[model samples]
Target: MAVAIAVTRERREGETRCAVTPETVKKLIALGATVSVEAGTGLGSSIPDDDYAAAGATVRPDLATVLAGADVLLKVRGPTAAEISALKPGAVVAAMLDAYREKAGVEALKAAGATAFAMEFVPRITRAQVMDVLSSQANLAGYRAVIEAAYAYGKGFPMMMTAAGTVAPAKVFVMGVGVAGLQAIATARRLGAVVTATDVRPATKEQVESLGAKFLAVEDEEFRNAQTAGGYAKPMSAEYQAKQAVLTGEHIRKQDIVITTALIPGRAAPVLVSAEQAASMKPGSVIVDLAVEAGGNVEGSKANEVVTTAGGVQIVGWTNLPGRIAADASALYARNLVAFLGLMIKDGALAVDLDEEILKAAVVTHGGAVVHEGVKG
Candidate 1:
């Protein structure tokens, strides 16, 4: 029997991206899986129902119909309680579960006798690179952050020499040189800005400079070894953080635009911009905090809101930056999910191999229990 894979519309507020697309639907069908998608699931991403039908997917109108007899459920975000209640017993669910924060959702899935896999928990191994949802989404987020900043900024990014006078290029400072930070640097440079960036990982300095952006960091022994083998940034000691803060504080006042992207897994985002630093910035300067959902890297940032500090610095704390560019984000995210699907679907059936490192690391709830080590108590 062929595995029944159903993709649902995202129910979370402000989530415009979908888990499946026409391109992925075709691929999933090629893998000998029967693919179904809820009607309007791709509307947000500008993918019409006709496109999915054309790609050999059944587009059901109601959630109940979509969930009916589904062997595997695909979603962009974790399922809500009501949605989970609609699932069949022993069904498999996959998405960016945010399992660390959504404990209640994890419990619900366990109680519903469903197997859940978190895309965000996919291991950062060479073989699992194609399934890396975080990198794919964050890459788009970085580019979108710069686009948002440029829209909010009063001056042009590139220097303009008009007949009247010469307008200096905007200065852009990006904190955290992860996937998003790297893309932000490249985008800002393309727009003719003078870009500089900081990250705890010493390996990022070369990446930043390679994009024609200046690297800023407190160069110390600890800074030289601040990255994990998994390519994640390690938390710095308090002493190092204090020194870095002081340097960043002084440097921020001169920047016309600042973007903060630092985030630690299962922890609050590190504060990179103090209130005083924000106050010191010139009026009309903009700061986009990509870590706002994790308690904001900029002091004045608030998730989903644009706030202007007393010093007149605009703090953009919009969550889900990639959602702002829904079409491309959906395309990349769907491809990532399809690649991961290939690991479990074989001979038109769910052949879950628990021994696979990627599957072992990503599976959060299986056999009516929490399975992932990090999610388990």
Candidate 2:
């Protein structure tokens, strides 16, 4: 018999992405695995049930029906403890397990004898790039951030030379130069904005310039060493932060739009835009906080809410920007999950090998214990 791969509807609020799409359903079936999807799972992504059935998926009416004794469970978010406890012994679960903050969920998976892998924990190495959930999703979030900011702005992105007068292009400043930051620069530039981006890591300077955006920052010694061995930005010293703040704050006053994407895993997002700095911007300017869900990088930013400063600068704290573009986000994310499952499936059966570096980094629970390095005892 073929291995059963069951994809679940996301129960987490504001999650519109699904683990599998019709395109991926066909791929999984071609691999000799039986694919089942929960009813209404793809509706948020604008994929109807008829589409999944046409693509060779069994559409179960309810969660229990779809998940019953499945060899594999795929999800956009981690399953609750109740859902994990219902799985068969040693079942394979892949999702954004968020193991660092959801330590209790890791313990539940261990108790249920389920091998759970957090897609977000996948290594940044070349071989696992296709399976990188963060990159796949952050790319969409970055693009959407610009669109959102443009909508909230008082004027257009591109400068216009009209018969009567000239309308100058909006000034966009993006903080943080990860996958999201790079895409944001590209998008903003394409929209004809004068884009300027800054990051503590010196390497992002070329990346920003490559996208036709100017890089702004103090290239001091601390800025050069601000990147970790894992390729993530290291926490800056207070003295360094103070120096960068003065430079950025003054620049913020002149920017028509600002987007901040800095986030530290398992920690509160560092405040990149202070309250006073936000209030100092031009009255009609706008700011988008992509890290709003992680306690926000901009002061006065609220999750899923838009806050306007007393000076009339709008602060957009819309969480899950990827979900705002659900269809494409789901497609790309589903492809990412398919790429990851390809490594574990062998001869039409479940054959997970934890020794693989990518799997070793992502597996949060196995053999009745919390196993990932990110999880402390």
Candidate 3:
């Protein structure tokens, strides 16, 4: 029997990126999979229905009819309640499920008897680089974070010397030196801002300094080794966090712009900035929290909303930063999906190699069961 893959039309709120593109549709068809797309699914990303049709896909206006016989489902986010109920038992789903963080959504998929793979859970390793959607998406989020902050800042970024007088460069302090933070630092510096960044992980100092930005050091024994084996920032001890918070609070008071990007996988973002810390900022300071979706690093942050602190500082907490650049974001995401797709299917056939490391780490639900240890737990 020929396998059929369907692309979901509905996207999560503020999600402009689609899971797959017509180009990828043609590739899947060449691999012997028939492709069905919901009408207008790719509209936000600037891809029209004619594009999918030209690539040999069937475009159905009704989402239910398109998904009725789908053996595989590709999506930017997890299936919603109505969508899950529409799925056939034993359907295979591949998407950025955000599974560990989305407990209710995972339960729905299980009830619907869908075999699921979460792209976010793909192990961070050289072999899995092509499937690393988090990196691809975070790179965009980081880039957009700087642009958004600069827009809301109400001042120039680069230092300038005019006929009137010399203008000092804006100072940008970035929290969390992961992919998003690093990119924020780079982007801010390109705009001529003096960037200073910090992270719990000691290794990030070099990365911060390598980008021609200063590294804010909260030197202490605990911070010297505050990293997991997977290169993720580890939560610090209470005593260490207290000392670092005091030092960071002092630093926050003097910056023109602050971008916080710290996030721990499967955990809520640590509260890095207290309300007192926010009040300490100058009246016109700006803070952009990239972790607003998973709680927030900044005390006053609210997802997709901006608030003005008592001191008149702007707190930007828009969660889906990458969604603003849907065209490029979707292109990179489709490449990531294709890479993961190659791992599960080869030569136009489904090959479920359960023991394979990549498959083992990413397959959240299979055979009517939650197979991943983390998800199952």
TM-score of each: 0.99, 0.98, 0.97
lDDT per residue (tens digit) for residues 217-247 in model 3 = 6778888888888889888889888888888
- lDDT of every model, 2 decimals: 0.94, 0.92, 0.88
Better of 1 and 3 by TM-score: 1
Compare candidates 1 and 2 on lDDT and give the better one.
Answer: 1
Clashing pairs in 1: none
Candidate no. 2 TM-score: 0.98
Count of steric clashes across candidates, in order: 0, 0, 0
Predicted candidate 2 versus true structure: per-residue lDDT over 168-227, tens digit per residue: 999999999999999999999999999999999888999999999999998899999999
Among residues 3 or more apart in sequence or in different chains, the pairs in candidate 2 whose N, CA or C atoms overlap within 3 Å are none
Off-target runs (Cα >4 Å) in candidate 3 are none
Sliding window of 10 residues with minimal summed lDDT for model 3: 343-352
lDDT ranking of the models: 1, 2, 3
- In model 1, which runs have C-alpha deviations exceeding 4 angstroms? none
